[model samples]
Target: MRKLIAISSGILLLALSLAWWMNSRQPQPVELMPILTGQPEYCVTCHSDLPEISASHPVETFGCVSCHGGERLALDADLAHSTMRGGANPSDLSVAEISCGGSSCHTGSEADDRDHIQRVMTSVQSTYAGAIANIRYTFGAQTDLTAHQGINAITDERTQTGITALEIFNPTLESNPMIQKFGEECFTCHINAVPREGESYTRQTGCAACHSTEQHQLTTAISYTQCNTCHNRGNYDLRTMTFVERTDHLTNRLEEYYQPIAQFTQCEYTLDCVDCHTRSEVMGDGDLHSNQKDIQYVQCKTCHGTLTELPLTKTLTDPNDIAFRMAFLKPVVDLKLGDTILVTEQGEPLWNTRVLPDGTYEMIGKATKQKFNFRPVMGTACEQKPNEQESHFCHECHAVER
Candidate 1:
């Protein structure tokens, strides 16, 4: 009975102490966040603590209103995002003109820094009409493969190529059942195709296919994984010579598959697609190419270097080109070739390249800072064709005994 009484008193004391502490403390004041300067947006009030999207798209300079169209002064979520384009992704074709293009970002010639919108429209990847026409022709539904068989973008004449008529799958137009079925089932890979709900970022339509590296984020360093989302899908029906839809099968690394048009290359497992393919090739040459082969001009010899002559890299008179100067922050190997200057995508010349003692032409990636060594095949025991420079001929050294 004595111990129980003492325990009750202790509990009463503890409760009184907690009440006293609670009574002593006053309510803290809420510190209001400040709006961002320059652009005059209140988005920074919330997203100020958030990480910057990328080095290029600085929030302080670009602000929220530039790429993502939103009410700068509004505090409410719905009001701020009321007129936003492409939701979280402004680079989408539907709103890309006002977002990514305009007179500012990515709006000049493809050779220049501002031609993404111009180049991509005519790119083979953007236009699935060629592929659709070819398949229909092969299946005997169409007489030839020159017809435009997909929804076409209304672009300028310079940007537009081949046929510009907007087309979809039509059973009535195509007499052959296979051609009819082909249009209905397999017509959504083009740039115009809107993203289905809950699709992967890589499978997204339009600029998102390459630029939107993540689900909602964008980046310059795109990986090969995204390329596989579209390229690795489906298969060819050898007997019928028709492309048939197949399930997206993810297998172990050992059981790998590649596009049959390309030779079974060592680079298949070794390098990323972007490593070999240049910006002009993938982004496009500002031409409406019939196929991917027409645009992709980077040969094995380009990177590996010719067997005999060495490429030169020289200095320029002045830093006239602002874009190139920014891209070339530092030299890779710093191996100076002759006196000729090396130019980047902008056609502005680069400097500070050197040749290694091993006879390899060492150069830095224009903007990526990637180190490259172009080995001259002239001295090597390579059984290349007479002036032939295909990858299949170069990959003979790593040929498996199969």
Candidate 2:
């Protein structure tokens, strides 16, 4: 009995020592009390090496629990991550309303230009409506090219276009085998769809699809490479119902920017997609559309004037102007009140562009931050006709050899 008691005491002592050593190896709990929630969180204890997410979303303001819905107090890795909102992405549409929405955040009044979530939900990128419409039309599943279905059913209350709702498109329900094949194969490029499994097709779903980089950092300075993940990665072989990946080893920016068959000018490849495409064009105008052409109205004449007239100019007079808000988001150019800037045909302001004293326009690249001074074709020696001011027409004379 005495020997058994001694052995039991020795085992207990060894267990206690092991526990003490493990506890010592664990990191000290670093408490953070965020101003937004006024709640204390210990996430920094484990994630001490992570950099600040962005300038706007400060750790001191928005603690990890706010965006990444994990346990605030729990220190164990599993317990901390068990209740995470979207597993590594909080901006995912599945939980965006709870994680990133609110009147103060992304889902606010359209008049105030804060309805980002709603706009994205109704956007063609998220719906994949155009591709569906085309495939169904080609395969005789639908009569016209109008979109009647999307990946998921969605309704827009204040639709400017005739289409106010889109029914959920189910590939299994589709009768046409070609349409079914299209649904099965061509559903990977949408913002809501999980991208194809590869290095080239790597991208997150929902808002992060466009706003976040591979590092999972949110940014407004989106580059051409980010857009290429979906736009220029590969083309689909409709005959075989398979996506053929681009096997060409690109040597220049022009080749890297677009596919070989595409004809583009120097500026098209020189500037990033975000540099020319407006917020509404890329994100959506809070309405459902049949195709990209319906929303994308940025013509060549929008920046470069026609031979008959100069480009439309709007001077910033109102402090509450949308241009000011746009400039605040980008911050590449300082847009002061009373400064004249170019406007699109639809009256959207080119916030980064400004008219110089010499009548030339200066534009700062949204992603690259490079400055370019250009004069409109109004007084130039160019022979472009007034009526033929489309980008394709300009490409006739300006297309660079690929």
Candidate 3:
């Protein structure tokens, strides 16, 4: 019995050693997993340990080479990186069509629901074309707003100025030093230009301007700090038409730098920029606008219940509203047919909500455990019968905690 046991132990040990040798002989992470579409990729053989970028993009399904155009089959680093579209960034507008976009992806076409590239191109934010036109016109260098006009090319054109309707201001060609200086100094924040090289957070431009957070994650629950990158930057002198660097560096409030130049009520400081700016207002609902004001024309009366009336309905039908939806898609949350009301994140009034045993009304955020309490504004202090309840008026008395 002892002899037999010894022989068995020796055989097990030899088998284990052979298995280890076989594993060691194989190339480290040489397995190329095929995705749902396109060719097999080997990029993950090296970047298998990279941090997750977002829930939207899964390395397992999309693979690195899908958005980032590189020689996927090449094992050598030089050959692999040879055809990289935008260095480490593929979402950059410069190469988005070939990188982040595809026929089924954000391919600059409205036929697909995921046409992000198409919408962003026409958006005022993407086409700083309007602002540049206005500035050049104001300087008397152009005959009209149409002179030196630049706009997004509706077709397959994809350059900095969106295929260029006409020649926008080129600092090298401009005879006026002021216009040249303005082009050099003031044009950094536009979504078209590539972000500054250093500072990863500051370097996230184009689609990343809003979707990418300070923590370097792609998310929708954005805050005021995200808006600070551009909105709360250096002061612009209205009197001299000059732009000056900010004195202080620490702050999330626009008032810290924009004070005296622009007025902000206490309400502006209390809530987030998204609180008032609806999805359409911020993201542009497939409709092109002239300027920032035209795009973000949200009024205070929209959210805060108006005088003598409530803006939102309080009735809903449950089981239809979900926990999660698309970036711009909101839940169906405003059903007037029933006794209870539920509001979707996108402000859509649909049939969804429930009734509690008690009289108080409540709602759960879509796909989240967070709850919202609904109150009628008809009897509240805001609904004075004969007076105007404008934003500036209420902000004077109801100040946010410092």
| Range of the 10 consecutive residues with the lowest summed lDDT in candidate 2 | 212-221
TM-score ranking from best to worst? Answer: 2, 1, 3
Best of the two (1, 3) by TM-score: 1
Candidate 3: 10-residue stretch with minimal lDDT: 321-330
Candidate 2 lDDT tens digits, 101-211: 899988999989899999989999988898888888888888999989998899987779989899999988889888888887888899978999988788888888988
- TM accuracy, model 2: 0.96
**Residue-level lDDT for 380 in candidate 1:** 79
CA deviation > 4 Å runs, candidate 2? 1-4
List, residue by residue over 183-242, the lDDT tens digit for candidate 3.
666666666565444342274666777766743356655566666666666654534546
Highest lDDT, which number?
A: 2
- Best TM-score among the predictions, by candidate number: 2
Residue 18, candidate 2: Cα error in Å is: 2.7
Tens-digit per-residue lDDT, 303-373, candidate 1: 45556643433344444553244333333333332334444333434342344566555555433455655
Candidate 1: segments with Cα more than 4 A from true spot: 1-39, 44-50, 109-113, 147-149, 159-175, 191-203, 236-262, 305-358, 363-374, 395-402
Window of ten residues with lowest summed lDDT in model 1: 28-37
- At residue 27, what lDDT does model 3 achieve? 56
lDDT of each: 0.58, 0.89, 0.57
